[model samples]
Target: MTEPPRTVQSYIDQTPAWPDGTPTDFIPMTAMQWRIWLLAPAGKFFEGLVVFMTGVALPLIVKDFGLSPAEKGIVSAAPLAGIMVGALALGGLADIYGRHRMFVIEMVVFALFLTGLTWSPTYLWLVVYLFGVGLALGCDYPTAHLVISESIASKDRGKLVLSAFAFQAIGALVRTVVGFLILANLPRSGRGAGYMPPRSCRPSCWSWAGSRSATAGIG
Candidate 1:
């Protein structure tokens, strides 16, 4: 069905006003604005990093946890469930509480949970940490745009937001390269050589083969 005509919110229609009472459209970026522009996309960047890094690490995770197929499925879906819950619950929290406030809170939560994930001692703990991380990321995912557009000059909004969004891709790319390097270079069990020879490498192969030895994991 076709939608009704759209209208911008009256508040949204009003341009941003900086603290120094500068006009919104044509001014240079302030230090705070630059900070926002640089940091806002961290949500996307971490989202991509977590998703791709999880896939890359799944084999080791499964092996370490002795997870069966069903359990593996649960492991894979836990973060997603947290994202769903965060989107439903935290989104409104931002609206009710405050966007910028929640944006900062979410990252603090994200960092806490991410650090917790590294030291997770059991499968259940791992799932919990992942869920927490997902929750923070989910809340911030939408907040990033609100924080950016409201803080930035209108002339630079499109360019800054798009570049910020690309952090997701950059994060994924960085993880893929890191994963591949570790796989092809590190010892399997402190015994023999690495998983695959460097000559056999391909940058594009990580999506499927990422969980195992980078080269071995690929088709």
Candidate 2:
């Protein structure tokens, strides 16, 4: 016998305690679903994190390094250009190589590039790192959604995919606030007004030069 469809009132009457929410309501997620949900958004989070952070940091980086217009343009475009290249050239490889392997590989590459970005010794290296970071993020963009969409219920796919993508906005907003706070409070000792590469990675020679420059400027 065919099942009867529910009335509008029946749908409205539902609540979470009604023996676990139905698909139309707060749909119950499986353990695998939960993991994919949490993990998928991470790609967008990093996309927003690095993209906004780089854009924000660019001014300070330029001021500190005294970049010309052409050099500045290249630095500005490197990551974005990488995103396009990666999506076109590398994203499709997930089909042949398998999504799981591609996902892990991309994230590993992202981490390495992110670490290198912090330790960038010169303009060329900085651009290279940024491009790599973007490339990794680009590769993850399609794979993450595919993983989530393929693994979840058809009813829940739209909600999960949208929520996962929203992380980019959240990441952008959070990083913007963080960048503002750091800029507002950082001690202005020479190059301190500019971006400070993390202490562990800061080059001693450059650090000394920045310090010396700051002292001279202060005087």
Candidate 3:
């Protein structure tokens, strides 16, 4: 007589070992792995936040700095340029040294440079600080990716990495909405109206978010 068809669970139960010769028992994500996974997305969020804030604050920056069109273009492109340099250079360093150390160091640098924006005395200074921010951010990309990929189980690796990138979109959206809300509430014509809003808000927001990314490295 023909035997009953085996169920999926029966097949799994019958399997003796993984390809690596380990037992085929189900393994769950560990606490440390989850922390690493969540931290990666926080880094991506700030990466997107800093990039979008440049555009959002551009008009105010132009007004404040009296930037020529050519100067404005350079200031806007500085972060992207720095990012390229950082990715090429620091990415290799992370691989050689270690991802966790690089991640913590880079996040601290990112926060420090972002905070420097609050006190920039000239357009050149602002550009320099922004470039530094980009450098740190560039280091973060590979380091964060490496940390998360190494920490998580193979089955969920791709999904978690993709989810981390999704936070970039979320960060962009938050910047837009916050900028709109701040603009809407300001008086149309007042002493400190347009001047303080973007200038004050951007640095504070950047510093706060950057610090959070830095602290996440400790977890």
TM-score against native, each model:
0.71, 0.74, 0.75
Give model 3 RMSD, 1 decimal.
Answer: 8.5
Q: How accurate is candidate 1 locally (lDDT)?
A: 0.70
Clashing pairs in 2: none
Q: Indicate which candidate wins on lDDT.
A: 3
- What range of 10 consecutive residues in model 3 has the weakest lDDT sum? 210-219
Per-residue lDDT of 52-143 in model 1, one digit per residue for the tens? Answer: 78777776667566789988888788877888888877877777778878987888888777766766668888789888878987888778
Per-residue lDDT, model 2, residue 112, is 75
Worst 10-residue lDDT window for candidate 1 reads 210-219
Error of 3 at 27 (Å): 3.5
lDDT of 3 by residue, 138-190 (tens): 87878888887777666666788888899889878877776666456544436
lDDT of 2 by residue, 1-219 (tens): 998998643443444355453434554666876987887667788777677777767766775567899988988888888888888888888899998899888888887777666667788887898899789888888889888877776667788898897998987886687667656654455654544544343443233322332232223
* Candidate 3 TM-score, C-alpha based: 0.75
**Deviation from native of the Cα of residue 126 in model 1, angstroms:** 1.2
What are the candidates' C-alpha RMSDs? 10.3, 9.4, 8.5
Per-prediction tally of clashes:
1, 0, 0
